[model samples]
Target: MSDASFSLNGTHPTVNWLGQVRAPGTPGSLPLIRQTVVEAAETCGFCDEDVAKIEMAVGEACTNIIEHSYSTQPLNLDIEVKVGRYDNRLEVTILDYSSINFAVDQMAAVPLDDYIATGRRRGLGLFIIQSFVDKVEHRFVCGQGNELKLTKFFA
Candidate 1:
């Protein structure tokens, strides 16, 4: 079964991505995730440049979900990737029923001397997502989940 499917929501096209994976491993589902996401992005009529950005951003997003979200046990992960073209822009949104478990803030800012000393990679996913997209917005839903949106303006 595929995690994503295309449907028409009024005038625009939509992709509903849904699936789950254990923390220990993503199984063979990882490829499917990439394929579906890439296809949806392509559907937005992105050129080579956009493709490169999508490659990185999508990989990072999927990796984050696989590593942080549900524990090793089989946990439900519902991901929705919607792509649309309007006003010469491609907008992509990734919605997941997951949470950020790592010390993101500490790692990102390097406020502590220790963090600076360690020089550990931080905000890699978020930074890449922000860099690749024109804009990003995130919101947390108490019981439902969280949403991370990325948009790109194309010529």
Candidate 2:
């Protein structure tokens, strides 16, 4: 599904947009979702630098979802990318069917020096999302799915 849904929430109708992209859990589908997110952020008046940050963070999150959550069935899984704008923030909610419980508090940021010295590349997506966005809310409904809400506030 590549259709976009629009809605206004406590903001000007013309300034708010919501788009959804559904794809199989694979790396190849990331660019399309990333582009959709970046375009939505741009429409919210985000500068180039901020838009790039949002793109990078969203890309990392999507990658993690596909890599970790759907490792067994990456090509057959359902992944959804929801992009929206409201007030002074641009938000993106990524919904996935994976039932893994995410612990935000336990996913602390590693020191730059330690990460560089170790040269290890794992468990960094959540950190990137936390650092790039002003607010993050995660919800896992018993029967529905996991919702990762990322919000980047305008400066």
What total of clashing residue pairs does each candidate reach? 0, 0
Error of 2 at 23 (Å): 1.2
Model 2 whole-model lDDT (C-alpha atoms): 0.77
Q: TM per model?
A: 0.61, 0.82
Tens-place lDDT per residue, model 2, 1-155, is 23344455835443344577998878999989998898888777888988888998889878877877778643477889888766667778888888675544247777667777998877667667778788778888765667888889878
Candidate number achieving the greatest TM-score relative to the actual structure: 2
**CA lDDT of every candidate:** 0.58, 0.77
